[model samples]
Target: MTDPSQTPSLDLPDGVAVTGALKPGYEQILSRQALELIATLHRELEPRRQERLAARQEVVRAIADGEDLDFLPETASIREDDSWRVAEHAPGLVDRRVEMTGPTDRKMTINAMNSGARVWLADQEDANTPLWENVVEGPMNLRDAIAGTISFTSPEGKEYALKTTDQAQLPTIVMRPRGWHLDEKHITVDGERTSGGLVDFALSMCASATLQLEAGKGPYFYLPKMEHYLEARLWNDAFTIAQDALGIPRGTIRATCLIETYPAAFQMEEILYELREHSAGLNAGRWDYLFSIIKTYRTRGRDFVLPDRNAVTMTAPMMRAYTNLLVRTCHKRGAHAIGGMAAFIPSKDEEVNKAAFEKVTADKQREAEDGFDGSWVAHPGMVQTCLDVFDRVLGDRPNQVDNTREDVQVTAADLLDVKATPGEVTEQGLRANIDVGLQYLATWLTGRGAVGIHNLMEDAATAEISRSQVWQWINNDITLTDTGEVVTQELVERLVDEVVTTLPGDASNYEEAKRLFLAVAVADEYADFLTVPAYEEMP
Candidate 1:
């Protein structure tokens, strides 16, 4: 354990306390100016953050009372107005043909920069655990990454460095900060923990926004887990304030909102309208969208219960509606329509690589044909896979925003057509959920978030969909197709026990992982986000 007395001190801004230990370089990242920015934002906007979060609970409560969600009538004017469009794409973001995403560690940063993708999503959200060290070092890595001085030497003597031969090929860095719902317990303002999103946004902007601007890309971001247009407005306000405080040009920061939540999907046009000045576009965060569906209507009935995670592909009818609507909304507003993640990681096995590559190729081809400007890939090896597909469609053009998909018209009923999704809940699917949830939680507790399991990169989003499905299954008494056994709380607990024994013994966190998984899985009340409770367990 780190000795509290030995922790370094900094000249913190008024009412701001760095309860987390400050390492040698941490003070530079959390400089006096950065703290001032954080403090100011906290004081000015914390109440509104609280209000938006409270509004989420209100929606949840209303849903439990059998309220069906639809586009807000009050915001109908914003959606109906076709005259307004987001500001033109910023420098280095005009052609986001292929973007790579991963946790922002020294090694991953170096590899992603060299991955040949157009944009690197330096993920501080689902793909990262907010360990105190990571909270400080993630921004540090990003700073070093932008400066072209980042390198890493693994304990096994393997060396990694950013490719200097082709500097122009370096991916534009688009940082994904933590969402509004989380708090940075290590940093307190007026005796209250500060917003984790604010901490990430402030530190990263302070450290690298100017450098990014000089490099031709402004401070770009991917906002996640927002459930309303008001949340987008909050981020727009933050961007305006941060740019002014940092002396960067107004509208220099461009952000793409992830329409992951069911509520967000309905308000896509309004969300774009809210951040039109600083909007890059919107991404189809598919995994989290499914999780949001289960979370929003888990109590409604079998109509809302989805099948196995693997069975629900992007081609599913309901998914098509969501993506079609996203593309239409974004393009109608003259914004980029980025597609969902292709999470398959290529393995050394030839057969596995061939099969996964075919699927990835088909997936990317579909997105390109569907008029998405670009899409996301989780692995460096898959960069070429995604890039080639977009290259074929885009040719000399930067993007396909002009393809407004005017023919596509999605109603509230279309977006909520969960029963139209094909596939079945099976015994194998149930066990996979149990297996993945426990394994992911175990590694997550140990402060590693982007984990590779069974040739796919598993992040917090995948784990969430996994465990949330289990909870929904148990509550609805879903029957496994193969076994004909009803999914009960007892059955889930028994499966959890079996999965525990099967986990690698070397992973010491599995015991705690089991307890945490059960806490979210079989609890009487559903947890809003597993990461919320899991954050308390982080080192």
Candidate 2:
């Protein structure tokens, strides 16, 4: 065992040592000040706290006395690991390779049978289909598409034929059921009997072996509009029922839930935990979540309105806060946190498109920095860009291992302490080490094929590797020198050229536009660093 008192003193940078010497006195003063502030707050909050406690007690008493209450089932039970049995028999779900959303959004269907993505989900919710038409023909038309007539458009604009009619060939294509309604008895949709509720219909459509025999692989489902843990549990229960009814194992069917609400953000851990055994992974639903936040918070009052559609900005702090929380939460639970959608492509004008692409590349870099494994793009035109970004950010590093600092200890005394606890003393040294390390890694990986830099604090070797890589990038001209120079258009352009376009495209124009946008956004994101002008020059 290590001796706490005899702990080897950490060799801190000079500024940290100076601050460490001055911390105790400042800590003493801060403690007194905090105590007085807390007392003042306590006096103000005591009455409201007492009233809330009393109200909660009354509700508890009412429940104990058996007063009727319409309680939703608790999510905790479904969160247990053993709640669902994994399917022993593999379902014959066909891989309907291509997914297409029409301009009007009404005629979504799958094509390129047995090709690219493992499963294809025909997007209906965000499509241009009229609600009534969707209620009537959405599922039926999709069913027909699955049964036959599916085709794909090749890059050369020629139509490639699909073998969708070969029921024995392709994976199952999943569709959202229309007019679904839930009640006491059997759930009903479009005058047909659905096994349970919305969830039951979904699982049955995706998990039945007999269905798999007809469809090839059993169909898969995408659960959207998820808001809470209980919502996930409800879906789990439906899946359980469907699996049992079809004599399949409990967790046979797979599903992906869209995280699209603020409440969903808070409940992400519980939701992922509840669906872990059956989930495909979580998709970041950017537009829907934004709409939900506006509705939930009623943000229209302050003239702080978002651009209607075309001119909207995705770099708002709130947006970053939500997505960052998502990345952290998903990694915490060992589940994939897919990045947000970047459905828009840069314009055809080479300069404009290149600039747009550059901005997107930078945005994706930020997402990669925050810990997303992959992102979504609407067009095949954007696939090369997506792959380029992923390759640059993901590099040759092994799959990301969870190194989150959940176990890091923080205390009131530590917060107030002026002297470093032989750990970290000066804020500048800590900041410099982090900045230097990250910048170095970013530089080194600039033109490289896939690379990964593990958390240095978690693995001792990672620190040495980081130091080595940083120097390598510096030497190779892959990374910017740490001479602390102000970032200029030339620097941004160089970084873009080095990192953004690994694909075939005349992207110069797009690159320029993206660079301008990124300059503004990055400056805002790192205002403190940008303001110091000198820091820009720091190596």
Candidate 3:
């Protein structure tokens, strides 16, 4: 006998009072229904929830076990001023050239060593010959092919020179791995393997050959098909071991990693960060990445076969997402962001070639606009075009203005007045105003201590317009020069004195400002001019 007050009571609305438990028949029905609903939900969601939980756990484990994570060996830190070190050894920097040596508009094979590509890749994996033939012809045949006498019979029985006069202008060759050789432990000899035991041997061969080739001219390598951080780590380890064996410095070898797989996309930032000290840059491998995704994720029972390679376009959202991520990731890490390679343009027809060139030019322009510093061209004929596009897009301009200068207000009306017709404003007045504004922009961008100015305007064409105007003024020197050369410090001082003697309205201060601005702008622009061999000796 419990007291009624001691029992807990449910407070209910007037109409909804307490009731006894349901009858057995109704209770059994409700219990069965509830159990069925719960079972249905568990069947629907258990696998998915478990998958998510497992993935989350994997990430947590990876972070928690950081010591086990593969990382590049510690190397010497690169100074801010040393950013351009790779440029020194780059053959592209010297000749502004890259040549494609391959079968070329026909069924043929090519080697990286003889192609004179600053970076050569052995075409072992993709060559038509059997594994043994590729291995034998790999470097040896490439040497003979580079020499003057090699020739091959076309499928139609027409004779063609293997070593064309065009090869003379080619620069740097890069070797690519052939066959099913990811590393020493995974060698697909005769299209079969026993224990995946020789993968290290294959990787070592690649690392050794790459280092040997890089020893003389350009110290560079292009690492392809990197699927995981451990893959990259393995290569770096092999590189380290090879460098020690060859007496080369640990970080002397510069390499570019190809992001050609889905997993590699997510790990790009981590990979770049891991190999920051050793990596030259990362490239988007659109075709191979697509192939990998389809092969890895597509259900075996489904009819998900991809179309022909030529029919495929790099328009997939995933491809663009990966590229955007790579660009953002590289720039954030202070590394160069190289856009993906353009498709090899066919045909020597002038109209056909020009059209192809224009397409590539447009592609490179878009990349430059998106903040990529450079890209790859398969044909040597496209090299100059690529450089010209980059030059026009990345025109030399000054940095952003500091807060101190941002407050310096110029009325819109005054800006319009600077461009007044010849009769409306004197040449001196127009020149002085333009000189002042340009100087302010340049000084702010370059941090007075900096030498060159990088144009930051969104419209590259408009920046070029401004650059042309400034160069014209310096070249003509109608106002402040007696000789043809730029107006010197002494000439500027004399002009200021003369102007003070004649004109008014802050004339002295304005002249002094104009002189300072013009001098620095000229120096900055002149440095860029020196980069062009023809302009090196220009007055």
Question: Which candidate wins on lDDT?
Answer: 1
Tell me the TM-score of each prediction against the true structure: 0.98, 0.47, 0.44
RMSD of each: 1.6, 25.0, 29.5
lDDT of 2: 0.41
**Cα-based lDDT for every prediction:** 0.91, 0.41, 0.40
Q: Which of the numbered candidates is closest to the native, going by highest TM-score?
A: 1
Per-residue alpha-carbon lDDT of model 2 for 347-416, expressed as tens digits?
Answer: 5568866776777677667766666666654444554565566667667642232533244333223211
For candidate 3, write residues 457-530 as lDDT tens digits: 11111122232334334333434322334433344445444534443344544443344344533443322211
Stretches of candidate 3 off by over 4 Å are: 1-122, 127-130, 141-170, 178-219, 300-312, 348-355, 394-539
On lDDT, who's better, 1 or 3?
Answer: 1
Question: Which should have the higher lDDT, number 2 or number 3?
Answer: 2
Error of 1 at 489 (Å): 1.2
Ten consecutive residues with minimal summed lDDT in candidate 2?
A: 454-463
Candidate order by TM-score, decreasing, is 1, 2, 3
- Give residue 238's error in model 2 in angstroms: 2.0
Clashing residue pairs in candidate 1 (N, C-alpha, C atoms within 3 angstroms):
none
